[model samples]
Target chain A: MAFDGDQLSALAAVVHEGSFDAAAQRLHVTPSAVSQRIKALEQQVGRVLVLRTRPCRPTDDGEVLVRLAGQMELLGRDAMAQLVPAPGASRAAPSSRRLPVAVNDDSMSTWFPAAVADLPADVLLDLRREDQELSADLLRDGTVMAAVTADPRAVQGCRVRRLGAMRYLAVAAPDRRDRWFADGLGAEVFAAAPLLAFNREDGLQERFVASVVGRRTTTPHVHYVPSQSAFVGLVEAGLGWGMVPEVAAAPLISAGALVEIRAGRHLDVPLYWQHWALRTPTLDDLTERVVRAAAKALRPVRRHGPPSTAG
Target chain B: MAFDGDQLSALAAVVHEGSFDAAAQRLHVTPSAVSQRIKALEQQVGRVLVLRTRPCRPTDDGEVLVRLAGQMELLGRDAMAQLVPAPGASRAAPSSRRLPVAVNDDSMSTWFPAAVADLPADVLLDLRREDQELSADLLRDGTVMAAVTADPRAVQGCRVRRLGAMRYLAVAAPDRRDRWFADGLGAEVFAAAPLLAFNREDGLQERFVASVVGRRTTTPHVHYVPSQSAFVGLVEAGLGWGMVPEVAAAPLISAGALVEIRAGRHLDVPLYWQHWALRTPTLDDLTERVVRAAAKALRPVRRHGPPSTAG
Candidate 1:
């Protein structure tokens, strides 16, 4: 319950590393002390938190303790970020802070670098994108302060801002489209049409098909292309047709090398910027930059969601 | 570059709870000490992790560190789990292991209880769902040792196992369908029809419309129901005709309350099971249980991406 920061660190490391010997090596602590410190904490908690599993384990009760121990590390790091704001500066940033964010792969790989480049040189932005959908779990577990998501609903204690819509188009090589639909590929023809998918969830094909067929099945005629660029390439190679982000598609569409299957129709996935309701100038700045970027990048935006009655 | 567990925990707590005072309360450290601890860490990390603004934020670099800290915590918890094999255990398991798992909402809600019930009492499963589309992300992060992903391509360290297809039926109340589509609905019908969406990621309606029309642009007539059961209930109430998971609709269809829009053909969302190539028994056991559950609950045959070169 009450671990001196060092003791907790030692405990967590020892527990994580399995043997006190292993943890000691990682923590640069002695095996004897590691064992003794754990015993002491076990005594303090009045519970057996760690099991003697070869590597080691925390009991259900131990998990509670370990979770706490883990939390301890998080707090320590936030504290650390403040103490040493800049390497050379003798004075600190007055208040030390840590910004936790959850982002999606597309955003992380394509957009985040640019966004960070726009931030103050000193301001830190921690980006973690598991899935934009599950990003809220970070919030639930008290991990991140902000997230970029397609959902408008806000988590408890958070505010939501519509970022705009990320439109995706189902495109393919002009030659491929011509071949596939030369005689005007209709329903049965689509059943045999070559298709590229972003992994499996790349439902642009499904969404495109569902939009056309009133939501049939994720067409069986599908090839699973895993990466973003590859999915585009597959479409370009005349291997199949897949959904490409409008921003990414703009160049290709203009090149006349790829044809939008359904011209004038795009899947507008509305996105939202959500963050804790707490007023931090830092959060304000992040919110501003993200919204501005989203506005420029996405379209048909509206600041909408269920009534904000909770706030 | 080198943060002992203590520093990481402290930072995590501060950013997570929003204030140093709150973080102190959570970590049971004095506010002054919390302040000092963060000060020390920032010095060590040589960068500002948090914005020190309202709530508090971690810089992008800070977030990377914080994410590392979070993973450290998770690893620490697993370590603890290994130490304590089971209740009242005197020693640790022969090996320490944590099974990272990816799952979706339906499977989680429907079969999770059974799956958990079926698992060995000693092992724990960290199940994550990217709703459906983003489920594969769990594979990418290594956060999950395994996942129930829609995507077939395996991540760098995992193997793919096909489970089965989750079928969805386009169903609605007779009155609603009759009122709207006496001769079948048109493209514009879906745009104005009371479409049901689970979250922003739920693309059932869009897919449905795409089945008939070319693609769905944007639908103004919409209802955002977050809960699965509630979403189905609204559709049953004739709020709008939307695609319902076959599992949820089974009883309703049997009772003749809900009519299938396009009967016989089910929107089969073929599911996949992917796991890391770790030799841990826990991961194997979890995989077995989940795969078994998927086999029983879903329909259609299953297929895997690539073999388990995860080892």
Candidate 2:
């Protein structure tokens, strides 16, 4: 059975706007019209698509439809951009398209925006700053069209392309490094030294320590600095040692503001661009920009995923 | 009936850790012991306190106990700091205390960290970077012990103290200002010029526009840059105009990279410190530092809150 574009658009709007009245305003229709469309769509599917909550949410079955709607929206916009006369060629102004994307904090602060700066002026970026480990969840839930994620595993109904690895170094303020690791790096030093973390959920420090110690050793003292820039600032301020992205840490190391706690120990997190399987012009354009940015900012990855394969 | 300290700690741990097993690891107790403590507390209150989800969450009833638990924990920590000898004096290292606080991103990027820097070394800050307009919600729900918030009205069981105002200026890159506002400030220009917002939920741009236009006016184009530093960076890159905090804008303004759209037309967002009414030494010390930092960094407020009060 064919899904009516109007009904799918109404469903996307209701879920996106979070209310029937708001959806109606966006669609330039009455609230009753939006409600009728939702009801008719539900009847056609023979399933309850939305949970009529304060902020309307899609049910499990509704998510599948929302993903389809999002894909169609992108394809439609791509088609229009190709067919419509360029701006200033005609009086008809092309409608702006919003592209929702998920990005991690480090990339957002560093290279991601550079890539975004190159996108077409008409595309509105709705960037969600999520953890690299969890960004794929946004794609799975249909909250975002694409994501810069670490997992490298393809989410169901999505395609994954390997971006280069973001290399991290265990660095500390010169004074902090001298004071904490005076004797040399050991399990005791790793356990006692106060660590700077992005947040409690951030596991980079733990993984870094584990790589050196050969076991998971909980550092007794931790300072949670949640901002990417500030996290680096705190490390430079001699507050604690932390895993600084190599791209961000290089300048400080050169300036003698920071020093690696142990020489040559590092973590290289492989990043991947995961997007809907559909090949729309906008998505493909964005993916290209993201991949290009990663190529410049990140180290070349030896292998992409956990289940290793020959390069 | 008296509340058990152990049970309260268990509740806070489980809720904060998001799983009983994780809570058990933090508390150094068996999962069954944590479960039993929760059950006993529920029986004592004769109310269901926790929802048994994958990550256990507090029920509405649970929040009350959690807040009480948080307050009690602070008081206990303060007492120990007073009663115990200094760290070097005894073999027993005083157990570290975790103080959770909510701070807005702009403040967190600028002055908030300075206040936190001066805090006693023993206090581990778990800072939640939330919007100033909504930071108070964290206090209301027992998620944070204190917040640097826009709302001066106290949350239930909390006391409010004014922390001066963060002044904001509508600024654009030199080229951007010359290009976009060459026609001078008017309703049409305001509606058509691209604006930078923290996010879709951010209403600062709309509010700034309304102040100029005498009513709410939607700007046709908006760029959502979520990072505080990156938001300013985008404005400096001549991407769009935005309401920049004066502290950050001052440097850029002096550097000739940014220019104000209209001279002397600024927004002063008065900030306040809201914390649990129970004044522990740690909380008081933190509050004093916050007030001092604000006094130095923020503009003096003419009055605080929606319902104005005589200074």
Candidate 3:
């Protein structure tokens, strides 16, 4: 059976607006009209789609339709952009489209915004900052069209591409370096010193310690500072040493604000771009821009095969 | 049948350090000694306490021991402070203590730091900034000893106290207000105009819309700027109208950078202070400071009845 696009759109509107009355206003129709369309659609599907509560929520069945509606909207916008005359060519104002993308906090603070700047002005970004390890979940749940995630595996019906790696260097203030590691950078010194972590999920420091000590080591005194800028600032102010992103640490190291705690030791976190497999102009453009920018700013992935196979 | 304090401390150290060897170093004992203590503790409890992972994690049983260790540490410090003379009086260095507290992003950006400044110098603050709606979850999981949350319900083993409400006003750039809302703050204007949201979880704008239109309304165009400062800046730049915290909107309103879309129509999010029920001196001091600061910065919650029993 053919599903009506208008009914699907109405369902999406109600879910997004959180009520039938609001959806009606947005659709430029009466509240009863909005209610009737939703009822007809539900009857056709023989399934309850939405829970009519304050700030309405989608039932599991409703979510399936909402995802389809969003994907359809994105595709429709792409087709319109290609078919319509360029903005300056006509008196009619060009319409903008919203593109939701999930990104990790570290990437957001470091290099993601610059990549977004390269997208067409007609594409409005609805950026969601999530943990890298969890951003892929957003894609799986249909909360975002694409995500920058640490997980290399693609979600069902999605495609994944390697986006290089973000490198982190163990860094500390000069005085902290002197006070904690005066003897040398060794496991013993690392065990005794206080450390700073982004949060409980931050395991970079522990990993570094494991690499140095040849085993997992406990950090007795840890300070958790969750903000990206503030985390770096606390490190600079001599609060404690931590793993600083190379992008944020390079300038600080040169300016003498931070010093590498251990030379020739760092962690590289591989990142991947995951997006819906649907081939659309906007998603293609976004993917191209992000890949190009990441190639320049991040360390390229080391190929396990010959150079000819690498790209 | 009593649990030894040293073994419990060793278990906590391993969990915190993420490795037995590191815990040993922090405890000033041999790695074998640390291992033996943990083994004895596990044997005594007849449950697997610590998972031997790269960064040691607590099993369900281990988590109980970890929580107990943390509580014991807090209580021990309070006892020492009361029994001993001030550090400077006898020329002996005072040992510092770590205190982990969860706070909402809005509070962290506004008045929460002032409350922290009142904490004793010997107290180290490990501040975890979580969404107001989710901060209480941290307390439930024993990730933090206290939290500033929007939820009035107390987590198990925690005490809850109301701390006024954070007021938010619907605001937009002056030019955007003139262009889109010139007709007035009606449903038609809201449906057509772009809006700003902190993230997908932020429903303040939707809530405000429901309040104004007297029903839930769909916002077709939205820009999600996750950072608090950036979210406000985008609204000021005419990107969209959004619900800005009264604390953040006041100065912008005075500077003429922003205009209120609906005057006198605002949303007040009631906030509550939740902390472990343990009545230690440090926790009491923190509670007092937070309560005092909230009174000065947030809108006072109106009393619903006679003041005789009011807290």
lDDT tens readout by residue for model 2, A165-236: 888899998877888888666777776677789887788898888778778787867888888877787777
Question: Candidate 1: where are CA atoms >4 Å away?
Answer: A1-311, B1-3, B35-42, B80-85, B88-104, B118-164, B188-193, B214-220, B270-288, B299-311
Instruction: For residues A148-239, write the lDDT of model 3, one tens digit per residue.
Output: 87777888768999899898899998887888888675666776676788877888899888877778766655777776765776677676
Better of 2 and 3 by DockQ: 2
DockQ of each: 0.01, 0.38, 0.15
In angstroms, the error of model 3 at B210 is: 10
The DockQ value obtained for model 1 is 0.01
lDDT of 1 by residue, B225-309 (tens): 4444445665676655677778778899898778876567456777788766554445556777777778788774634453211
DockQ leaderboard ranking: 2, 3, 1
> Model 3: how far is A41 from its true place, Å?
12
TM-score result, candidate 2: 0.92
Clashes of each: 84, 0, 3
Pick by TM-score: which candidate is best?
2
Report the number of backbone clashes for model 3. 3
How close is every model to the real structure, measured as TM-score? 0.41, 0.92, 0.63
Off by over 4 Å in 2: A19-32, A53-55, A88-94, A304-311, B19-25, B53-55, B88-94, B304-311
